[model samples]
Structure formats: C-alpha cells, structure tokens
Target: MLRTDYKPQSIRQSGQLLQRHSSRGFRWAFTGTIIGILLVILSFNSGSLADSHASQLSTEKNKISAEPAQQQLSADKAKASIKKLPRMNIELPPDTDGRLSQDQTDIADEYENAFPRRALPLSIETSLYDESADDENPNTLTAVTVQAGDSLARIFQKQSIPARDLQNIMSLGKPVKALTKMMPGTVIEFVRDRQNTLIQIRYPLDETDTLIIDKKASGYHSKIDQVKVETELVSVNGVINDSLFLSGKAAGLSDNLIMQLAGIFGWDIDFVLDIRKGDRFTVVYEKRYAAGEFLGNGAIVAAEFVNQGKSFRAVQFVDDKGNRNYFTPEGYSMRKAFLRAPLNFLYVSSGFKRKRFHPILKRVKAHRGIDYRAPKGTPVYAAGDGKVIRSGYNKYNGNYVFIKHGEKYVTKYLHFSRRKVRTGQRVKQGQTIGYVGMTGLAEAPHLHYEFLVNGVHRNPRTVKLPQARPIDKKHRTLFTASTRSLIARLDLEDRIYLAQLDRINRQQAALSNSEISPKSAPQ
Candidate 1:
C-alpha cells in the first residue's frame, strides 16, 4: 500500500484473486447451511422417538409389577375353597383270585368246608349170612307191591335208581317181557347191594315166577319164588246233573271209566234221550295195591245205573269157556237187537200214531214214524250198519234214505233237506244219512225215523239194540288179572272219596257247634 504502483498486469491479477477467493467462500457457506438444516431436523425426530420409547418401557414395568399380585389373590381364593370340602372313604370288592384280604380268604374257605359228605355203610349181617349159607344167601327180603298204573321204568325212577340199570336188566328178553306186562297190585322184590345198587329184580310170569340180575358185568342171576296176596272190594257212587261226563268227574271217575259205564248200559238205556236228572250210578269193583300205594282203577265188575226210578244192574262174569259177558243177575243178555236212538239228545217232536193231525195238510192222517225235532241241517245217522235200499226225493218225503240191516232189520229216514248217501250203498253205524229240514209235508226241521221188522213198522225209541263182541278166550285170563288190578284202583279211589267226605262233615259239624254255642250264650 505504501508503494502504490499502478500497473495493468498487477491490477488484473488482484481482481482475479479477489474473484477466486469470493467464489470459494460462497461454496463453503452454502454446504455448511445445508448440513446444519439436516442436523436440526434429525435431532427433533430422534427426541420424539426417545420419549415414546421411555413411555412404553414405563407401561411394561407397571404391567409386570401388577401381574404377580393378581395371581397371588387367585391362588389364595383357590386354597380357601379347597379347605371347605369334605373327605371321603371308599371300599372296593375283593378280587376273583381269592387273595384280596384275610377276611375274604377265610370266608371262601368256610364256604368250601360247609358242604356235607356221606359214606357207604357195609352191613355185617349180610356178610354173616353169606358165610353161614350154602350156595344161597339168607337175608331179610323187602317186597314192594306194585300199585296200579305202575310201570317198570316209573318204579325204578321213583326208587331213585339210574335208568341205565333198567336197560341192563331188560337186556334179558324173556325176563323183560314177563316183567314189563306185570299187572298193578302185583308184588315185585328188589335186592340191593350195600351201595344201594339193584342186585336183582323179581316178578311173576305165570304159575312160575322169574328173577332178573341187575349187574350185567358180573353175570348175576335172579331166583323164582311164588307168593300169594289178597285184595279188597270197594264201591263208588255218583250222581248226574249237567252231563254224564261231569257227573263221573265229580264222583272221582276217569273219562275212560265213565265211557265204559255208559257203554255197558248203552243197550237198555238211551243215553242220548233217556238220561234224566238225579240219575245215580254205583260201581263195585276190586281195589288192588302192592305196598299200600294206590294203583289204577280196574273194570266195572258190577255196576248199577238208577234212571227215572228204574234200576239197571249188570255183573261182568267169566263163563266156563273163559268168555266175558255183561249180564243181569238172572243171566239175561244186557243186549238187544236195535238201539233206541242213534243221537243222545234228540227230541221226539212227533210220535208214532195211526191217525194224527198233519200240520201242513191240516187234516188227520196216518203218521207211522217218529219225528225227531233237531236244528235245521242236523245230521241224521244210520241207526245200525246196513245197506242203503233207497235214497231219493219223493212227493211226501222231500229227501229220504232207507237202509236194510241184515234180513230182519230195516230203517227209514224221511223229510230230509238233502241226502248224503246213494241207493245200494253200504253204510256203517252212525253214518250220516241226511240232514233235517222242513221238506215234503213237514212243518219244521226234523228227522222222521222209522224201524221196521220184515217191513212192519215199530217204535224206534223203545227198540232193543245189539251187543258188541265179547273178549276172546285166549285173552280171558290176562283180562281178568288186568281188570282185577284196575278194579282195585277204583276201590282205593272210592275210599279216598269217603275219607274226603268224612273230613268235610267234621268241619261242618264243628262250625255248626260253634255257631249254636255263640247264640245260646247269656248276653
């Protein structure tokens, strides 16, 4: 500055230096301003982020501190509730292997020891008798009387013997056949071993007796011996009210026995039509027993049926020829040539008459046959076995059938709605001939029945009937034995009924005495 020299080259150089310095300073200033603005914006944003982070950390600390207190309160409540409950005791059942407990094992042992045991006792007398006897053992024999209806198998079962023993004993054909047919009231002896096993079974064959061995393996055998027994006679009485079947049951009679009684008196009495109220029957027969046990009832050896004040008695007798026949006391055959009626309950709507007023014609006419009143379409049967002679319709008889029985018997059925048989046809007894109807000159449904002997008309209701064939001579002896046993059973039944009646009477008498005593007491 002191030397102020003014030169063109120096001036130009100075201005250039001033311009370069100013340019450099302006560039530095602009760069510094931009960096400061960036720093300020970054500082403001970083401060906001730090504040938010601190607030989040404080909330997390508060949550961590409060969680433990809530959990402790929940745990305390749970413990208090747990303390308020009651305790329990439980019992379990014992195991199946019997190792559960001492008490259980002891109870099981006691149950096993409680059952009873039995031992077989040998008889000393049997041994003594066997040693003293020669080839035969002498011992007391017990006999069992065979009751009526007792079968071999049944008796063995009742005595508690194994049925296999019966089969072994029956292997001997002759002994089994003889014993199987034994009649009720017969005596059978059974010999048993010490073990209660049957040793021998003995029964009668005919006049000769037989025995059977019980043990097949030992080849044991039976001995035959003869013994006699006695039986008693008994009577049974019955009265009829509703039907013959019921009356027989009321009197302790079986259906088969009642039917036999009905058949015995079927000839003289028409059970279908002639049976009346208060008809009483009494049968006297034998009662048979083996060892005081009841057997089955036998035949009606003698019977009486009192009907309508008339008494009919029949006695079964075996003649010299060994033929059995039912006859009256005076030896009259209890049989007739024709039965009174085929049906048991038919009614006589019209009777046999010479002159009778006809219902259809309204005039007196000859009515030769008996008209039986029955339901419409009631079956009309052939009274006996015969051949049909005529079966057709006629003017007076709408439908008719005429049957000829042998040479002396002829029967006619008229006024039928329809015919069942044809002419020249064979018919059996009780075969349906036609049906009842109001046909021809009849006023109602009925069967006009007629019986003729050699073409002469007779009364059908009072006609005699034929008898059934008697038992053969060959079976007579067996029949008598069997019948006697059955009769004995019937007798026992009668005694039982009498005993029941006595008991009833005693009860009634006691009741009557009690009632009278109460009335006579001073009140």
Candidate 2:
C-alpha cells in the first residue's frame, strides 16, 4: 500500500496489459459476429424451405384440379367409341328349351315310315289273301275325303259307325256341331286293327298339317301342334278427316289395323264423335307370318296421334304385375269406366229435345229420339248386344226396327233406307241393321235413333252409361301376370325409342359445337 499513486514504470508491462484487454474484447466481439452470421443463415435457409413447401403444395393443388378434367375426357372418349360400335342383332332361338325336338323327330320318323319298307312278296300275297278271307277280322285302311257342306258326323254316318260310339265321342267336349264347322277339302283316314276296333283316326286340319287321334284304355287322346311364325315391324301413317275406315284405306292400312287403333284410344276419346278433320296419326306395329307367308297385323307397339293440336303418344309395355294400361308420364290410366258410344256412328243431326217441330206434321211436338245425319243408304249399326223385337213400316216413321238389348235397355231405329234384319233375329253390338234414307217424315236423309230404359225414352247424348265389370276374382291372377309382361314390353320399346332420340339430339348438338367437317359425318 506504500506509494499508492505510482503508475506502471515499464512500457513493456503497460503494452502487455493493453494487449490482454484487447484480446479479450476481440474474442467477445468475434463470438457475437459468429452468432449473428449463423442466425442470418438459418433465417435464409428456413425461408427457402418454406418457399419449397409452398411450391409443392401449389403443384399438388394443380394436379388435383386436373384429375376430374382428365377423367371426364376419358369418359367422353369411351362414349364416342361406344357410339361408333355396330349395333348387335341377336336372334333368339325358335324354341326356348327345345320344346319342338320331340315333335320334329316324330314328324321326320313319320315321313320316313310313310311307305312300308318291303312290299308283300307275290308268293306270300296269295297266302295272305286266303288267310284274311278265312278270318272274321277285316284288314283294310279306309280313306275318306271331306267335301263342301260335309261334316265329321256326316262322314261318320256314311262310314256306318255305331251311334252310341259317336255319342260317347261327342260327350267328351264339344259335339258334332263344333266339329261340323271344319273347313272342307280335308282328308280323313281310319285304320282298323285285327280286332276290328278303331286303331287310329287321322284328319288333315289344314293343307299343310294333320292331327291324329289314338284310342287308349283311358279313352281317346289327340295331339295338335300349331305352327308359329315370326313377324316384323311395319310402320304406317294417316290423317283422319271423315271416318277411320276411309282413313285407313287411304293410308294403305288394313281394316284390322284401323280397328285396333280405335280400340287403343277408345278409352280416352270417342271415335264416333271426337274425330275431327286434320287429326294426324302414326303407328309402328307388327305383322305375323307363317312359313315365310304373311298372316296378318298383330298389335300396335307404339303410336302417336295429334288431335286438334294436342299430341298423345303411347308405347306398348308389360309391367312386373302384368297390368296393361296406357298411362301418361305420370302414370295415369287412359281408360275410363265406360265407352262414350257403344255403336260408333257418324254425325249427330238433331239432339234430344222436349219440344220440336215435326217435319211431316209441321207442328211442334216432343222429339224423344236422337237423329244421326248420314248419306242415304249408309248402314245403321246396333248400339249394343240385343235381340230384334220389331221390324216393320209405319206412317209417321218410314221403315223402323226395335231392338231389346238387356233386361233394362231397349233401342229403336227409324227412317232407314231398308230393313236387313227380321224380327226375332239375334243381333250383336255394332251389327249393321239397315241403310239410311228419308223413308219417314224427315226433312233430309238422316237416321232417328232412340234409347229406352224400362220402356222410358232417354237422352242418348247425355245418358250416363254403366261401367263394365272388372275382371273376375278367379281371373285376376292370370290377368295381372299377362298384363305385366305386355306392359314391360311396351316400356322397353318406349325406353329404346327415347334413348335413340336422345342420341340423335346429342349428335346434333355435337355437330353444332364441334369443328369436325361435315364430310366426316355418317352418310
């Protein structure tokens, strides 16, 4: 502690102290600079890593966005290929499970066995004839040809058969009345065994076929094989102006086809009254054939009718339950409870009225009947099923006829051109009774029609008709089954047609939007 103010005396000592302090400060500064440099590098590296991660996320988002587009493009290409492919035409087998195999074999065998393999030898022919003559049994084959107006009963009578056997055979089902209705020009063959009993009875049902009945211990058994034919689609179009029959003829359609069309729309519209001019219609239907020969038109598969600017379309279809009913897009039945007119007639001239001027009497009188206007000689039809009660001429009414329909219904027709039916004659619904003429005190050529319920006159135009009975409970099951199949068939046809239309529309849209040249389109 002596001489406390004394500073360092040696320069070297002062220099050493200064150098040590500088070194320590320099070390601390160096450490701080190194830490700052490391922090800067770490910040740059972290920023670079974040940028890479962002870029990878952006690339993943882009791929995800393009995946749906790529899939859609692939699907479009597949659809194009499918559209370009040829349509497949599959022909189903004639028989589903070889039902005709046995029949076919039997037919072939019968043809092969038509003639005996060996004829009787001349040496044995004399012995056979002598043995046959000595024996009580007759060995002969009789062939009978059916002529016009000849029936099975007449043929049997000619053959001298026992009446008791005929009666027994007829009692099985239908009597000779049913069998006698057979067409003429058919041949029948009978073969007798050694016991003189009928061994076989064969007859030609038609020109190309024959049916055989064989005697058995259980009675008689017969085999009948019907020939089925394939049919093709036929399309027809027409415009109805006057009558359905005339329109069908003009359109090159058959009467049966016209009737079927009327039946299809009968439930919704009355063909007798609702038909108007310019009503157009188109039908795609089927025709039946047998052995490459035309039979007739079968049914209407699809149809379109444009009536008074309104269009109605229907497709034949069978459903799962087999209930056949024409429906709208919403599945509403087209059929109502009853038909508008039982007899689809022409036009109505005079309607029902309480008081009307009599044409002949020239005075106001009660008009109880509906008058239909038609050309003279136009046939009049029966409104319903009934029996003819009266057919005669009168002073006020020219040539008239009265028909008793059911227990509670009666109808009358007056001023006819002529009477074709007689009293006590059974008439069916829509049966033509006579022509239209001014035979009575009518102003013009017209038909006077009347409907009576329990002998009281009713307004024919406004009368409320009774509904047809529904299917019987016993037949409901069968009806439902059959209807479902038919409905399904109709539905399939409709779907196919709609799909075809959609494809056409899509093709048209593509043609409008695409850059493909018109020459590339299918011709």
Candidate 3:
C-alpha cells in the first residue's frame, strides 16, 4: 500500500550503513532486502510508480513554459472590458499654420495630464482662453509706422481706429498735439481689445524717451517715460580736406553735431565766408548709451578749432543756476552778442556794395545791405538781443522788422512773408522774428539785411559785433573748477596724436638703423 519513496541514493546509502551496523544480523538485513525487492517488483508492474516519476520529471523540465491558465483568462476579460468602453474623437481648434501655438500647446499639455484618457470629459476647450492669461487687457500691441504724406487722422482711419477717439485725444491740447506732427519713420504702438477700443498708446519721443497714453476711468492720461541713458566722453580730430561739413562727417560726427560744432565757433569764424583749407578741429563731446545700446550723440563738451592758423579752445560748463554754456579757459563766453547770419540762408545773393542797380527800382542806387537768398518761409532770426523798434508793411520793403540794439546799433530785416514780433517787443538774440519772402520791391525770395551805426548804413558782414557777457565774477570759481578736467580732455587729443607720431618716428628710426647696420657691417 506504500507509495514510491523517490530518494534512491539516500535509500541505498541507508542500506549500506545498515549492513555495516548490523553485520551479525545479515540474515535480518537479507530478509528485509528480499522483502523490498518483492515490493519493488510489485510496484513496477503497477503503473502508479512510473506515472509519479514521469510527473516529477515533466514539471522540472517544463518549469519555464508552465503557468496558471486562470491568470491569462482574466487578462483577456480585462481587454474585452476596455474595448467595450466608449471611443471619443475630440475636435481641436484650427491652428494658423497646422501646428499649435505656445498657448495651445500649454493648454493641451494641461488637459492631457489633468484627466485620464478613458475618463475624458465630453469636451475640453482652450480657444476661448486669453493668450496672455495674466495680463488684464490681454490685447496685442499693433504697430503703425508713419509713411510719407501720412497724417495722424489718416493713419487712425486706415487702421480702423475711431475718429472720435483721436478728437478726444487732440482735445487735451498742445502736449497731445505733438503726435499729429510726427515725421515719417516714426512708429506708434496701440493696444486694443477685441472690440478695438484703444487701451493704450506709445510714441517714441526720442531714442530714450517714450510718450505713453493710457485709458483711465476718468479720461485719457498721458505721461513721458525717460529711460536712463549713460553718458560717455568722446573725442574726434579732423582736418579740413574740402569742406567743413564733409570733414565733420569724416570725423564721424552726425549732421546735428556738425551744425552744433559750427555754431560753437560760428561767432568768431564764419563757416561760409571764413573757413579755409588746412583748417583743423578737435571736438570732445558726449556719447549717450542705454543698456549697452548706442542711443545717439549729445552736446559738445569741449572743442578746439584752429582757423587760419589761429587756435581757439572752448569748454562747456554749467553755472550754479544750472545754466549750461561754452567758454574759453580764461572764462570768456563763446557766444557773441550777434550771430553772423540771422537765417541759415543758401548764400549771400547780393553783398553789401557802395553802388548797384536795384532789381526792383531798375535804377542805380547804393545797395547798403547784404541780401540773403533763401527758400520762402525760411525763418529769419534777430541778429542781436534788442527791442523791436519798427514792425510794419511798406511799399518799398514788404514786411520789415527793425531792432535797435542799445543806442549805437540798429538792425533792419526786409521782405518777409510773415512777421512774428510786434513793435516795442523785447526779443532775445537768434529769436525768429519773420519768414523770408518776395514781397514788394523784391524780385525773388531774399532777406535784405542791413546794419546801421548812428543811423548810417554799414556793411552787415564787416561790422564789429559786440561781445557777449563774460563769466560773472561771482561764478568764476565754479566755472573754473568745472572746466579744468574738460580742458584736459580736450588736450588729450593732441597728446594722443603726438604719441602716435612719436611711435611712427621711432619705428622709422629703427628701420633706418637696421638698414645702416647691414651696409656698415665688417667685410
């Protein structure tokens, strides 16, 4: 009835140990072996022992392939259950270029992560969300560049902006009126909502200044925002090759800075009449910057102009009153009492002569003053600070303005298209008093300027001009202390030039020495 005990080696070893221990009891061990042999013979005939052995061998050999069928059946049931679930085909909003924008991508990522795919909601939408969710206005800034012949009203109309809004903005007066006169290439930015109501506007006043206008609860409010710009000292040395303007351009000075340079020395040296070849100049000025970007050039800090072998140096200084002006090292004002030419005219059409035939009178008469030909509407300025003694119309002289500078000098301007000053009005030097035009007694648009001394006509160009006020004694110390460093900076140009020349000379000397050494070597 005993089943198979499958430990054959242990059973054999146990039998040997029994034989060793029970050597005297061989009869009993032999009898037990005979009984075990008889039992094994009976078990071999019966198939139960062989079946148990085969089952053990088959399980050990097929261990990798063998698994419970119930687990696989459960997996199949799970797949079937998942397939029975509802399939969802969600439609997304059309993208501009067949690809999602950054906003859409962010929304998609959030939706994908927040809800499970199998348990997705009926629909998840992202199109209605604002592109800039954090911004209160959530409006895009639209840029409108001013083109030629474009007006503020025209731009607004072209962009479909409201005319009433422009009118309301203009009602704010002169400060807002500046936007109407923006030149071509100026860019104006407008921020508007979906309804196209202007939320904000920005116009660049200059490189570092932006005029900002925003819609407020009460009304529209405007303010100027100035970016911090760094100022750096710069210097340029240029010699006259052909013309002062060209030389200034070669020196890397812009047109505005060149005009400023000429103005600094214009009192003493006339750029048109007196500037000659070989004249040289050195300018130390300000270079402005903001956030490592070059904004533009600033004022002339100090300058030296050598005209006709005469050297003149001017240093820019600010007084205790915060008034800035250029002066010589000896504290003399660079500005003169009168400018050479009141208007920046094209040329002197007719020089002051003793006798000449009048173009309009058609008779030989003494032409006592210089006539400056310029475009109509060119602004004519006062030559010196004075009170307007006479301002009226005449048959011989169209629109005239006469200014009496003290008791000694009286200046007259004739043939103006318009007059800006009134009689007995005090006007500063260089103040625009009228515009050039061809009216009564003039064949063309020109300014007939006259300089009178003691009520007698004198040459406007050759007359000696009065000197401007010098540095006041009270402010001399402040001006002197401020100009020392600027003077040194001006002098640095010459020092640097001399150092370059010295370096070149030394290199030439070294080259000559090397050549002479080869020639004079021992043979």
Candidate 4:
C-alpha cells in the first residue's frame, strides 16, 4: 500500500533505472534488425551466384552433348572392327548323350562367369597321347605310376574315377585280380572319352602281357593281351682271375645268369673246391625283347667251361617230345645220377677220413662223412631222387635223414635243425630235404653228409657217380642238326675272345718294351 512516508528519491531512481533498461532494449532491437538486413542481403547475393553457376552448368552440358555423339561414332567403329575380325568357328566334341553332365555344366558356368562378354568354347583334352593314335586305342590316355603304399581303390579315388567302375572292373574276378597286387612304379593308363568318362584302362601284368579293361554297353570287360617276344642271340665270356661270381659280375653277368652258368657245369666241377685260377667260360644265350624293349636273359643255348686245363662244352637241345636237356658235342648228357655236392657249401670242415679228431667227442674217430661248414639254416638238398629210409634224431647226429637211392646207394644227411621228408617220402635231386643245424653232439652249425655204396661208406667227393642216359637215339640226329650252329657260334666267340686278349697282351707288351727301352741320347 502507498504511504505518505515513502521516499520520493528512491522512486525517482527507480524511474531512471526503468528508462535506462528501455533504452538498452531499443539499442539491442536496432542492432538485431541491422544484422537481419545484412543476412537477407547476403542470402540474395548467394541466390544470384547460384543462378550464375546453374547457367555455367547448362553451357557445359551443351558442350558435352557433342562428346556422346563422338563416343557413339567411336563405339560404332569398334563394333565394325570387331565384326571384321576372323570368327573362329570351333566345334566342340559331341557328347555321347548329346548333353553335358552336371559337373560339366558347372565347369561351363564358371567359364562363362570368367568371360562375361563372350565365352569361347573352352575345351581341354585331358589325354596326353598323340591325336593321331590308332583307332584301336584312339581315346587319349592318362598314365599314373603306382607309388608305394597306394592301393587300386586309392589310386582310382585320387584320379576322380567312379568307384562303381572300379567295382565293375573287379567283378571281372580272375582277369583283374592282379591289378590289386600292382607293384610300385607300375604304370596304369586310363582312357577317357570326350566327356572325361573312364572308357578304358590298361595295366601291364608282366613284360609281355597287359591287362586291358574296356567299358562296354553291358559292363567293363577285361582281357589280357600278350605282345610278341623276339629272341636275340648274345654271347658273354670271362676269364676267372678270382672267384667265378666276381669274374662273372666283372663280365656284366647278372646273378641269375651266373647261377645258371654254375648249374650247367656244376655236375662235373665242384664249384666249392674245384674252381681254380686261369679258368675261363663262354656263354651263348638268348636275350628276349618285346616292342623293342629288352625283357631279360633267356635260355642258355650253349656254354663252355674250361676247368683245370680241360675244356667242357654243352649245347642245349629240345627234343621232339618237348624235353629239354644240355648235351655235349658228342650227345652225352650233362646231368649225372647224383650231384657231386648235395648242397651249396662255403667250405669243408672235415673230409671223409679213416681217422680224425672229433671236436665234440675230443677223440680220434672215423670221419665217414664230409662235414660241410655253412651258415646255420643253409638248405641241404637231396643228393638224388630217392626214398627216405629214416628220418630221426640221435645224440651224435642231430636231425638226420637217410635216403635209399635204388638198391645200391644210400645217402645220409646229419646235424640238421629240421627234416622236410618223412620216413617214406621220395625226394628229387636238389630238393631241400633239411636245413643245417648243430642240434646234438656238436659245437657249431654244419651238415654232416655221408655217402654209402652197397652198405659201405665211401668218399662222396671221389666216388664214381652213375652216368645219366645220353640223348635218345631217335632224337640224336635232330639234336646234332639243331645244336651244330650253337656249338660253332660258341667256338667262334671263344676264338674271338682269345684273339682280343692276345691283341691286348701284345699291346701291353709293346708298351712295356717301349717304356723299358733306353731313350735316344740327345746329341
């Protein structure tokens, strides 16, 4: 409420303050109005600048309008050049069903995506064979060498071949069973048609036979085809300065060939005892081939072994009855009724003697048999075709086998670890009757072999062995006619070898003489 006592000075000051606030408000409103007007003018100028920029953009658009036509002309010229290019008309191989498989379709889709503008008919023939191959096997083949630890199923899986086809091939039973036993490094060829479908397979069974599996309308059919093998005559000769094996190896003879050589002359010469230095041998043999590739060494047509200054030659003859045997130039058989040594031995521990000191008994005793010292488990062969009379064990003789050869001769093998024949089994010559062992009353592994003639012990090494029958009288003429050239070739090869040796010796002697001769004194 208003009272008379209120101070008028305070009221006047309040009025002055109100006046000042009113003036400040007016000044702020004037400043805001000026700023608004400036903003409007700037906005108007920005609109004019935008209009000028729009007009410049319209003129640039008009200038670029002719570039589209020029670009169109260039594109037309490019199209014309593309049309003028040589069109390669490639014809893809037709499929059997006149359609692509799902896999082929997917591959084709990938090719199309890779080249979207124009996808050329891309064909990759998987065959590594020449296109000019014969019609019998016109389909290209991919060869794979079987690696170690790889099975046929694994190989087929690795090649992406259908398991059903492998099953069908195996269904052939006997013919394709050998495929499961393929050795490492065996080459298997797969022939696929244009569709990459397995059409044929070729697996070589041996040097001459190849197993071929062809996919037919019914199923896979398998067969073995043999190549024609040709036999070529070859000769090898060696002089024995050391052992026969070493000399033969030095002369480039394989182990098999060397063993064959030993077998041919083994009846007459004791390879363990009789082979001496200065001995020589000549072998005329056959080397087989199929399709220009060497197969292996074949039968020995003729051979000569000179032992202890005596020359022995044998020529092979196949009779009319298909029986093959080695015969001398005089038609005498090379085989005897009994082998000179029943087994391949390293050395003789004890010879047949009237009296000798026994290692086990430690006393002088009659050593009726020859003790052949060989490694334990060495095979002991039957000396001849004979029936076992006794096969038993004794304290003195370990595992013993006694065989009766006809009515006159008996052979006994002792100190064997085991016996192969029973009491009545007939054994052939060179048949392994038992292995060597010292089972009883012995110190080391050895075979004690004894020869009995008419119930009396004889020296097996020096005994007169019964002679084998000569070539049959009926085939004698045929044998002579067939083996004449072989003997001649053998002799000729020997003479040529001797001549070469003589020439070499002469050259060596001449060199030695020249070396030893005094050089001409310089004047």
For TM-score, the strongest prediction is 3
- Candidate of highest lDDT: 4
Q: 278-377, model 3: which lDDT tens digit per residue?
A: 7889988899999999988899999999899898899998888889888888998988888888887777889998889876678898899999999999
The TM-score ranking, best first, is 3, 4, 2, 1
Q: What is the lDDT of candidate 3?
A: 0.84
lDDT against the true structure, per candidate, is 0.71, 0.70, 0.84, 0.86
**How would you order the candidates by lDDT, starting with the best?**
4, 3, 1, 2
Per-residue lDDT tens digits of candidate 2, residues 252-362? Answer: 888888887886776556666777887877777888888988867777766666677686665564455675555432334444343344444567777889998876798
Better candidate by TM-score, 1 or 4: 4
lDDT (Cα, 0-100) at 253 in candidate 4: 86
TM agreement with the true structure for every prediction: 0.41, 0.46, 0.62, 0.61
| Model 1 collision count | 16
- The 10 consecutive residues of candidate 4 with the worst lDDT sum are 114-123
TM-score of 4: 0.61
Q: What's the CA error at residue 295 for candidate 3, in Å?
A: 2.2
The clash tally of candidate 4 reads 0
Runs of candidate 4 with Cα error greater than 4 angstroms are: 1-205, 210-224, 498-523
Candidates in order: C-alpha RMSD to true structure: 33.3, 41.1, 20.8, 22.1
